[model samples]
Target chain A: MSDQVVSPRPGAQVQLEMAEQPEVLARIVGRRTELHELVRSRLPSRLRGISLIARGSSDNVAVHARYLLELATGLPVSLIAPSIITRYHHTPDSRDHLVVALSQSGKTPEIVDVARRLADGGGMVVAVTNDDDSPLAAAATVTLAVGTGRELAVPATKTVTGQLALVTLLAEAVGSSIAEYTGGESAWAALPDAAAQTLADERLLAEAVAVLQPRGTAIHLARGLTYCAALEGALKSKETSRRVHEGFSSADFLHGPLTVASDEVAVVAYGARGPVLADVAETARAAAELGSPVIGVGAPEVWNGVPGAIGLAVPQTLGEALAVIPLVIRGQQLAIATTLALGLDPDRPAGLNKVTATH
Target chain B: MSDQVVSPRPGAQVQLEMAEQPEVLARIVGRRTELHELVRSRLPSRLRGISLIARGSSDNVAVHARYLLELATGLPVSLIAPSIITRYHHTPDSRDHLVVALSQSGKTPEIVDVARRLADGGGMVVAVTNDDDSPLAAAATVTLAVGTGRELAVPATKTVTGQLALVTLLAEAVGSSIAEYTGGESAWAALPDAAAQTLADERLLAEAVAVLQPRGTAIHLARGLTYCAALEGALKSKETSRRVHEGFSSADFLHGPLTVASDEVAVVAYGARGPVLADVAETARAAAELGSPVIGVGAPEVWNGVPGAIGLAVPQTLGEALAVIPLVIRGQQLAIATTLALGLDPDRPAGLNKVTATH
Candidate 1:
């Protein structure tokens, strides 16, 4: 049994897909000019608001969208609770609102259901999905394809990045320039190479992996835009490594979940520059003081000075949202690496269907 | 040191507070008529929407509000991203929105900040907090005090129920009659005794506890209103037992997170009679088949027939939202009981403050 090598060995598809994120993102960036115009053309001239409906990793991406869209466009953005449609048979009036539904399969029953209802409610329905031929695309007023050909691994690496890229374009369409929004204009175009750099950084990734005790639980923390990275990171860890990794808004942690921190647990936090970074540093310091092993992912200055913290500085970038692209890859790599260390296959996470069906 | 018992031993405050929920809820229910009049007077003649700003356990309670208010009033409800105010200094137009901010202490800087910003945006701000003299109440146009007095335990059981009760009363203020909202007309009047009945059911709770292996992680599942119970349950387990427990929308879990379940994990699911109940039952069946222990909390018929599943039927009720109150108490008890089983103090979770001050 020990000598037999399983087909599609541990971490195979996930590693391949993670490596492909650079090319996939570059493709999205190269098409940004066309994508931006497409989004602008579909959007209502005077959008009263924006509401996003999504599930799983796509939902984490929507969290980033909520922050960016509201800040840039000065419009209130919401994450629609799909059960209100699927279970309660209710659809709050979305007239004149840009209701965006995101799904990798474009066939998740709830996501598709939400897209249809938003359209029925006079919303400007925009479907952001990987499948252009799926029912979600057919139901939407406009479809923004992710363009990632196929995602074999159930954990969803490239598709998540693809969704983030499309939402980034959506932000640009809504009158937010990358430079003004994040203070890093070149950051969008540089994402591919940045992700590649993160994927290739074996030194930090190895050190971070070594710091993880094989079977310990993990707590992820972040604030503001980078917080979505913390969530996606935790999801990846949970899906692939089958570890108990939950993410919290860093500020939310100080509220209650901080009690779970201890030497027996690993705390992974994401930070960027500014006051949010200060909170992250304090969180790391506090977690370390409680004897929890702290792995910090952010700019050097954010985590470097925190005593007893291990730091993995994602490539420096200005837009906090754009910076998350590279940071998320770091998390994906860690999850895959951790899965391999545990002798599990990242591609075939136990009992996971490629496309889960639930009403 | 070994012979001396610590004062206010760990878990004591949490247990005492849990026991106080019935009295506290009864007090709130007794005031519903007068409280309803006060809320009606404070609200605008025509509200465009509702936005709730909260953090931690209070935020989970807000999830319940989102479902109830939207289902009843046909108005859009959103859980505000507090960082948008505290960090970004961005206030999206909330002109006719009834913005409600909740906090146990009414002193969480972020919640207070959100209330002030909502007030600045021409929104009628309401504060649901335990402290009427606190800054959040001062910043708001109106305050609905939870009246839990001083909640010394870090886990926040009584105040959470107190806050839930106030939100329930607020729903009645906004066009939802207690009888029509929850199918059972007596649900509201019966809440106090229902909670008391749950607290006295030592047999079911003991069975539930025995099903929870001391060091194993637990996954909580539910749909619609009961999902909030799943979240609070997970939070209590995290705060008190120091165990890895996370809540997920039942449908969302199928998309991902289910991969983490195994023989070493326990699944605690909340269910009631509805279409959503079928999804919960299937989830329990699936998790049990994956070799995880399944403890179902709902009506007997929803879970009793599932092979290898243990059912703890909560007292039956009509409104899905109303049913959550008793279920949450069960979760709180499991958290404290599990803490005892693990030989840990629930009253003082490591490194947690009663009021977390984070920016």
Candidate 2:
């Protein structure tokens, strides 16, 4: 398995490693102030609606942004997919809508097209991207470069978190106190330390991988913004480990998916702050008792009343950080572990490609 | 395969057959008018804010109701899953909310509890159901009985359509002229005949089934009120054929799932009355051209421009009816075909029971 690992070009390898680091994350966080300043200055203008557009992990970031902005400003906000907007091209009247496009690689053709359409339709455009000179940035009315340096992994890590932070700042600028509502400032500050702490807890992570490695299927569960995170997490787990995973709202899991719980299945529940969290946790624990391995990810103190439990007390800040980095590591570990279990190469699966393009 | 067909009990078989006939459907439609009258008389009082509670297919019906009501009255409405509300039982002040629960059997424990919770909490309760004497009917402040006689198929068909029509009527009664918006009394009256005509198109039905049967995965796509119908279709497909299917809005599909489209897969696009339908049809057609077969279900003239299309045109009313029934038949056919492909009995799948219950 180790012999099969053909390392990428030296520069790309370094970028990938940097993308996995806590310090790199902190640097991305520092740029939020500038982005917020720009967004605040434009909020009072006669914008009819706001649209956040992205793809894959960036799409999840847009969802978080939409939720935050809607809660903060009570403004009409819609999460737009670049493919949906461009390929379908439902032009909102230029007089009212603002389009915000998030893309780690500002060159993704879909993102560029969506931005161009909004600009062409005379809607205000804001591009949040990791690359400053990319086409998406060039096409936008205002470009908020997410200074995340470079990202190399196919599954976005640091860039997505950076994007979320940047979007939150934008939401705040637009009079959404969601950051305050969600203890955002503290959560942002705690992220770096949280990343460091979670990584330091290698023993717990190793245990988690051990429990999850044998399972062929998993259910990823959470609510609200965390639900979006769970979906990305599930996708990461699938793409990296070649496992079948489905994401569901925490409460929704109990309605039907719970019936299929088995000893070989694992249920990963993200405990978000809500009145229903306790009930969701209890249900997760019950599933564990019923044979499915259950992993609870949330603040430690939050599980006080959760019954029949196997708790993995993830810090709130760490929960967000781990949403990206830990999943990648775990996925990588599972790949290696499963390969060894089946006597195969960890780095290569038959008929697989690192980058897939369908003609 | 013929010999493998296990006959259901006479009474259940009769009920099931009755549930599929035009007369039973018409009876349900008549009940919808009565429901509309009841709701209209009580409305202006229930107009401020509405919250709907439902589960499974019934939940989908509530979404349709929410959409039509919002369109008609411009009222604030929310569709709440029973599990979510039940989990958040601590929220005592729900008086301003009007809760409508839709279930065919009125026996699902979750639905029963939701009705009791909303009614017991002083929220207005309305049950749109077939079983007039069922517990859910008794628990509700108002019961709108479809009187569809009985439904024997494990996968619900006509009852769901009944629920949808009833909910639409209820929405109309609550201050929105949904009937008028949908083209007045004439259109509503023509629906049953349209539905029958659609069913009689056996060749189109078979073609749709053939396209859908071979796929390992499918995605049912729709938007707005029809989005809920898409969900029900996906759920039915999954439960009956044990296939992996997901539902998403026409606009939402481009976010990530489009990456998986291949000729071997199938996607069923539900066309609704709106500009979005053209975009959805075009996207589906593109997907079909890329190899995934796309089955378009809608009014004939609505998606005339869809590319790479194998179009199945049904009248608007017929489209709704065709959507629910053909899937049930397709499920049965797929199960039989797959069973033969795998050299198994058409009547049974390994490790599955006629009734599934888990503690």
Candidate 3:
């Protein structure tokens, strides 16, 4: 008997979520004035510095926030290690500290614990979460509810970009306004369209997915403000595809990890047109010189003619600073494609749950 | 064909340096009062936060310092991304900030540039490098010379531990006195012996090596402050062994990365006697349950009786806070062994220079 042909099921939940990012981000950005008022109202009269508390995809948003807040406030920003509070019981003198706590589910035990403790220690804890009534929101002084609705899939997609947009709004509320760089309020409004169009380019998306080999060494490299996309993309790929892809700043990679670059490895470079876009291109070229397959990220035009780089491109219709949204969606689509290619279900990656109660 | 083969050359420079960590740590700790005074004198009258700037192995040390400084000062501490300054040229208002910059050779251009900018922007910069006369030292308010002397191997051993000791001293100097937990000054004095003894366990070391199958996925897991060891160890192994190993906080690992754990992978857990050691053991046990081989770091007694783990043991004659030194030494030994097993030169790891001029 002749074998009957069958097509594999696309990871429906994750795929839908990835496609829903634009709407989720649009919904969050739609509440811009409200977000600003919420954050600004909770701001301590005299803020010393900012510390971000998050995990998983939210933690990647924290990286984006660290860069955004520091550049905007001219004050130090840190990504808090919750273990300092949870495991070691160190009640750091958080007075004058503005702690931005992020959690999509808002019920992660450690995130709630740290937020509660820091608030108790007199820190201004601003909780960025979807569930305004969740424990983390209760523990914080103020909650900037994500309000993006429910997110499905073990590997988060819409929530990832939604949180990214929320943080960008939070940064502006905390006094970081780069209207010239980020295209102002208009860019925030336009981000959803940009993300949707980026996903619409399935031909190029598949080409980018093709650049990633099944299971070997892979590095996601970017620099400056956009490095967050590299990190978020790497994590998503690992979570959904069961392939290990690390993220590093192109600058950091050149320092020492460049030794690992070879033809066997895939270099997914998040190269966009910005202050450090050339730096990302340089790193991609260097890795390419080492015989590494270079899959360039963000805007087909950005990488289309770049030396030794395949354009796994997205359109940066929004301004440079807002490019992170499209870049992250590119990562989400890449992960889904990679997962399907490896005959795995992105909606249900092995050994993962939607909400990780790490504590 | 005649069955003739030449014996491989053990990477002598790296091997010698690995054996010299105890001495290097002893030398750095010997200058305790001096390190304390240098950091204390440079502390601003009104300190807002601490920012650590470093690269490569030193960046791993910076991670450890981040936890230590935050706990000690009750002030926010950050690991500075040089690109934010170098690429974006944002001169963050660094007033009242204590910036601790670590570079083995003070000549790394980016480190020097950031230090100079932060210093000029009114931050107190404490330069920790071997060369007191180097540009980084010149750009700082004070320099706590890592004066463990020149490190020759591309895979630095003594400098790594030396920087570890110096950061510990810096932490104590800046205010953290974990004397009760770390066994006080005597613990500092005994750290070298602990490291030396840790290196002395060749049989256990070889067994740990055997557990790590040739050229596959490996993960170094730990929690709390000792998580720095897992990160540093992963980096060193990548630099030396060229075998990719990722590091995660045992807490963070359980979050979502546990999906990658399988029998085909090796799990090297930095399990020791401390607040979060049990959490690490739990992660190790979990990974073991997933059929991954678990190689434990630190005192044999700490992991010897732990379920589902093999002791790649080190003695913690000192206290838990001081265990990092020996744990790092264990990493160095493991890296050396891993490198040898891969039939590569650890002394001169492929494509790495003793000084990386990454700008």
Candidate 4:
């Protein structure tokens, strides 16, 4: 349990939560070894694959986990469409499967249903949550609790990044070679401090916000690991500002949706130093050349020489996988600033509750 | 191999292919038994899970297969993100896995790489393609071919629906009791007729177009089985028109992003008589209440009494799973008509090639 959150100003809970991310990351970083041991203990010995289940912001975190698991452990991953179990009543077999269930509150009914059923059917359920005693946590074989205190705002900020941190720890534990590419566990010590530096610099987020039009579809693009940040960025913009901010894989965007890229759409491309960053950069450059305003999210190096784009720089990480922590903070900042620009309260997004009860 | 496609007029290839759905469905329907036997022969002994690999429109069809496989076979499924294989070079163990590799062209480099690598890793590769002689077919343990002639148009209509038809057959074969819910293999005999009847009717799509604005975001909503239709519809619209047409899971919409629903946006809700239909209708109604124009895609029963929405009705299928065939046709028609309304050529989409080489 955590203390009640209070805002310095009226309707500023989301802003406050957004600011708390670094401290939360620091706490999570301190317990990385414990988190690793916990995940290692509960992992299925025969680990055939993974079934990830979550909703809303947590669901985006699951996508990041999918890429991590496959790349690290060579284990295929599925984000369970909870409706397949909850509504369709299909009790899918779970032998040798690991269900990474995530929820900020650990209370989404459908997620709980999925985790419980999969666990009952011979799967290992690992609950990544702020609440360690919620229904979801009870159903899990182990809980990877990364508490970000109490989140009073509807749009998740600290809680979600917390989920990302925990799942990244998960990938680090099971994936033996993941550490080599990403500076390993030793490098995680700098995560919280890097996040703080990112927060101190608002120029990149401001640059992105300055180019974004008040109307029309806003596009977000990324490849590989950073794609999750793009998705969360788009969702936050939509929820808080009521703007149609859309996200797509840099590769997936080229397949067809590239037609929508023009001056009317502001495209934000996220990347870090890794395998697919060049391709992502190329896609962003192509969109910029097509007259769409482009905002590139990465370290200064990602945009220092790139033309036709503004840079949303953060403290660079060793590899693309670990870059998600700071990139997500940048995304959340973009959403907050965008919401404020639209004269809407960032703390209270419309048509949403702290807990969305979707069955 | 198939005949070269000729158009009656310039930029009419996509329109012509859209009109050929019934014939394509008829051919696929006639060979259900053969498809069933082929799938049975290649079914992995003690199948542990399924890995679905695809991109663009073919990828949406893979999502449908995912739902079908999980609902029927009770086996977990994972959609392989090709980057992990092609970019990262991770050789995941695919033993005891059924890899459903879909590419209408079967020439996508990434899809081929994944299918080949997974097969080499011991997965049973099943290629669902229009080109039986393509690299993907060579990489497969079995190939399910559903030819619809050459797709000259940049936007695939018949080829995509053909993939849908074949995957439905694949589902029917493995998802044994899936028939009891969806009226069985015998009921598949009416598939062509049903598709023809759907094509003959155009009022529903017209109704939808009348309400869709020339500018702003268009949202497509669906749940479970019919979610595939909504995704394809959005993709087609984005490709054909330079418009922003987005898709989401009906249940997933309420969590956030609902704030974006307003008069400036158009919402299209897709459903069939299934467990989650009511929830989808509620979401559409909520969006309509927010002043966003609403289009309901399904049979007469789906929209007969529903207020605050225009209906895009199709010939009724027996159950939600079977309904995707007709719903997809309706979605394609919507995209074509939407493009025509925008003074854009449907046959030749801007910023798109027939096969997008993402890798």
TM-score of each: 0.96, 0.66, 0.94, 0.96
Label model 4 with its docking quality class: medium
Candidate 3 at B277: error in angstroms? 0.6
lDDT of 4 at B139: 98
**RMSD value for candidate 2:** 7.9
Sorting all predicted structures by DockQ, with the top scorer first, yields 4, 1, 3, 2
TM-score of chain B for predicted candidate 2? 0.82
lDDT of each: 0.81, 0.57, 0.79, 0.81
Specify the CAPRI tier of model 2.
Answer: incorrect
Candidate with the larger TM-score of 2 and 4: 4
Error of 1 at A98 (Å): 0.7
Q: Candidate 4: where is the Cα deviation over 4 Å?
A: A1-11, A300-306, B1-11, B300-306
Off by over 4 Å in 1: A1-8, A175-178, B1-8, B176-181
**lDDT accuracy of residue B158 in candidate 2:** 65
Writing each residue's lDDT as its tens digit, candidate 2 over A1-359 gives 22223544322432344336567557756766776777666553765556777765677677666655655554435554333344323344444466788877787676787778778877778888888898889998877776755554444556665676666667777763554344566766766666556545544555566667766567676654455656666655544454445666665555434544557677776665554466556667656665677766654433454443345544455333224333333333333444344343333333333222210
Docking band of candidate 3 = medium
Residue A338 deviation, candidate 3, in Å? 1.1
Per-residue accuracy of model 4 over A83-128 as CA lDDT, tens digit each = 8888888877787888899988889899898898899989988999
Error of 4 at B134 (Å): 1.6
Q: Which residue pairs come into collision in candidate 4?
A: none
The positional error of residue B208 in candidate 1, measured at the CA in angstroms, is 2.3
